[model samples]
Target: MILCVRFLLDARGEALLPDLLGLLGELTPVVEAAPPDTALADVRGALRYFGRDAEQLAALVRVRALALHGVDCVIGAGPNPMLARMAAREAEPGVTRVVPGSADGIREFLDRKPVVALEGVGRSMARTLCTYGLDSVDRVAAAPLGTLQRILGAKAGREVYDKARGVDRGTVVRNAAARSIAAERPFSRDELDPSRHRRALLSLTEELGVRMRGSGQVCRSLALTVRYADRTGHTTLTRSRTLREPTAHSASLTEVAYAMYEALGLQRARVRAFALRAEGLGPAEQAARQLTFDPADDKARRLEAAADKARARFGERVVVPGALAA
Candidate 1:
C-alpha cells in the first residue's frame, strides 16, 4: 500500500515541530518530522482503526489538525510519497489534494501542470524544453526519454522522466534523520560579478561544513540554486568524488562549492542571490575518507581548519567574505 501525507502547520516557530509531531501521533505511530512546518506519516495501519480508506484517513488527519489544534494544512494523498508531496503543494491553503493511484489517475493529475512543476526539472532545463514546444508536464512525459536526456544531463533527465510518468519508487521513511547542515541568503539587490557571487557561495558552503564537523556529520552532495534578476531560478546538483570526512574544514567545502559555481557559467548574467545546500549527510563514524595526493587540496583544508577555530572563538561576522561586506 502507498500513502503520502503532509501537514502544513499554521505556526512557524520552533513550537511547530513538536505540535505537528503531536498531531501525527494521534493518527499513526510511524511519523517523520520535516523541519520548519512539514511532516510525513505512514497510515496503512491507521486505516482499519479509523474505519476509512487512505483518502478518508488523510481527511480525518487534516480536520483534526484544524478543529483540535487550530492548524490549517493542505493534505495530499497519492499511492506514493512523491505524488502526495507534489499534490499537497498544488492545492491552496486549507484543502486536500488526492491523486488517484492508478495509471489513468496519474495522467489526469499531471495533464495541466507545467514541466517545471515536476520535482527535478529546474528553470534552465524547463526553458530548454519550452524551446522544443513542450510546455506542459504531459508533453515532456510523452516525449522520448532520449530526447530529455539530450536536453538535460543523463542522470537528471532520467529522474525527470520518471517523475513525469508518476513512477517515483521512494517510500515514506519514518524517523528519517538529517545528515547535513545548510543555510541560504537571499540578496536584496541583483549583482553581475561572478567573483562576488562565488564569494557568497563559498561562505555558505564553509559555514555548512563547519556545522557538519561540529555535529559529527559528513556531506556527499552539494546542491546550488541561483535566482536570476527576473525572478526565475536554476538549481545545479553535483557530488564529491568521496565522502567528506567530518572535520569542520571550511576550505574543503569551499573548493567543491567554487567548482560548482563555475560550472553554472554565470558570466555576464544578473544574479539575485545564491544558495548552497549540502546533502548526503551521515554520521561521522559511517563516513569513509579518500587519500588525496594533491598538495593544493591539503593546503586549502589546513587553512580552513584554522579559520574555523577563529570563527568559533569570535563571531561569524569576524571572517566575512569581502564581497558580502556592506
Candidate 2:
C-alpha cells in the first residue's frame, strides 16, 4: 500500500522535513519526498514484516511524527498513489484515513464525489463536463468513452474516465525532494482579519528573502498555500506564479506573493495557516535581473541588501519593516 503524508512547516522547521521523512524511512525504504512538507511511502513489504495493516502502519507513523517532532500530519493509505493522496487531502490534521482496495469499496467511495474532486479535473474541465450533464464521478463513469473523448481530447478523456471509476495506475517513485525553500505561519486559531493575514505574509516573505539571499540562491517562482479552518475537505489551496525574472529580493518576492494572495480574494477567510515556497532555486549570481531605470527600485534593492547584512550581523528581528516591528 501507498501512504501519503503532508506537513506544513515554517522556516524554523526547515530541518524537520528530513527527520519526518526519516521516520517514514524507518517504516519503509520506498519513501518519496514531496517537499516543503509531504512524503509518500510504499509499505507493502513493511506491512508483511510488521504484521500490520496499512491503516495501523499509518497510525504508527502519525504517532511517531507527532511524538518526535511535535508535528501533526494528515495521512492517507490506499492501494495506489492517487487514492492515497486524495485520501490524505480528505483527512483532518493528525488523522489517518484509509481507502479500501476492493472494487466495490472504491466505487462507493468515489461515485457521489463531484468530478472536480478528482485530481486532474480543473475548473475548465469540470465546466465542460458539467455542460454535458456529467457533474459527478458516477456520471462520468457512466459516460461512453468515445463521447468523453470527443468532448475532451482522447488521452485526457481516457484518463478522466479511468479515474472516475477508481482506476489509478500510479506508483510511488522514490526520488529526492525538489529544491525549494519554504516559510510558514500558523495562527493560534482561525484568523479572520485581512490585516493579520498581510502581516503574516510580510513576515514570511522577509524570512524567505533573508534565507535565500544568505544562501546565495535566487528563486524563479513563488508558491502560496493557505490552509483553511474547515477540515472536512479542501483543506489547502495552492497557487504558484513564475516571476518575469529570478530574484532573491524581498520586495520582488513580496510583490508576487501579494498579487497571488489578492488573486485568492480570501477576505475574512478562516485561515489556519499560510505557507510560502520559493521554487526553482539556483545560484544568485547565475540569475539575470531585469534592467530597470527607476532609482527607487534600485534604492529598494540596495536597502534590501543592507537589511540582509544587518540581519546577518545583529539578528533577524534587529532589522525588520516598521509594520512588522509594530
Candidate 3:
C-alpha cells in the first residue's frame, strides 16, 4: 500500500521537511518527496519487518516524525496513490486516515465528496461538471465516460473517470531531484493591504526568475502559498498554475503570479506570509522560445537582458522594479 503524509509546517518550519524526509527514510527506502511539505511512501515491503498493518505503520511514522523533528503530519494510506492523497485531504491534520483496499469501501469514501474536492478537478472543470449535475463524486462516477470526454478532452476524461472510480496506477518514485526555485517573505505584522500583497508577490517572482535565469533553467509551472494569521490557527492556502510553456522571464512569472493572486480575491485577508515557487524546471536551452512581433515585448526582453548584465556586474539590487523602489 501507498501512504501520503501532509506535513503541517509553518514558514519557519519548512526547513525541517528535509530532516523529516530523512526520518521517514529510516522506515522505508521508498520515500518519495512531495515538495512544499508532503511525501509519499511505499510501505508494502516494510510491513513484515515492522510487524504492523498500514494504519499502525502510519501511526508509528507520524509519532517518529513528531518525536524526532517536532513535525506533526497527517498520513493517509490506501491501495493506490490517488486514494491515498484523497484520504489525506479528507482527514484532519496530525492524524492517520486510511481507505480500505476493497472497491466498495473506496466508492463509499469518495462518493460523498464535492467534485471540486477531487485532486485533479480545478474550478473551471468543477463548474463544467456541475452544469451537467455531476457535482458529487458518485454523480461523476455514474456518468458515462463518453459524456466526460465530450465535455473535457479524451485524456482528461479518462484520467478523471479513473480518479472518480478510485483507480490510479501511479507509484512512489524515489530518488527524484527537486527542480524548482522558491522565495518567501514573512510580514513583520499581519498584512491586510492588497497593494502590499501584490508588491510582495512581484518581488518573489522577480527573485525566483533571476535565480532560474542565472542557472539557465526555465519553469513550466508557478505555485503560490499564502500564510494566514496565527490567530486563525496558522492556516496556509496554496495554489499552482501550469504556464503555457516553460519560461525564465520575469514578465511571464509576474503575469501568472498576479492571476493566481487576483483569483484569491483577498481584499482584507490578514496574511502573514507569501511564498512563490517556480516548478517543472528544465534547461533554458531545451525550451523553445516563441517569436514575438510586439515592440513592447521585444523591448522588455532586451531590457531584461541588460538588467541581468547590470546585476551580474554591479549587484542584485542594481536594477529593481519601480514598484519595489521605496
Could you estimate the TM-score for every candidate?
0.59, 0.68, 0.76
Name the 10 consecutive residues with the lowest summed lDDT in model 1.
234-243
Residue pairs clashing, model 2: none
Instruction: Encode model 3's per-residue lDDT on 205-316: one tens digit a residue.
Output: 8998898888899999999999886564768889999998899899989999999988987758888899898999889999988887899998998999899999999999
lDDT of 1 by residue, 235-315 (tens): 333333332453345666777777767776775667776666677777868866677899997887677667667888997
Clashes of each: 0, 0, 0
Residues 1-326 of candidate 2 have per-residue lDDT tens digits of 89999975644566788888899999888898877678889999999999999888988987887788788888888888888998998888766888899998888888889999998999999999999999999999999999999999999999999999888887787765456988889998889999899889999888999988898999999999998866484388999999989888888888898899999988668888899999998888988877989999999989988888888899988899998998
RMSD score of candidate 3 (Å): 4.3
lDDT of 2 at 191: 90
Candidate 3 steric clashes: 0
> Which of 1 and 2 is ahead in TM-score?
2
User: Order the candidates by TM-score, highest first — what do you get?
Assistant: 3, 2, 1
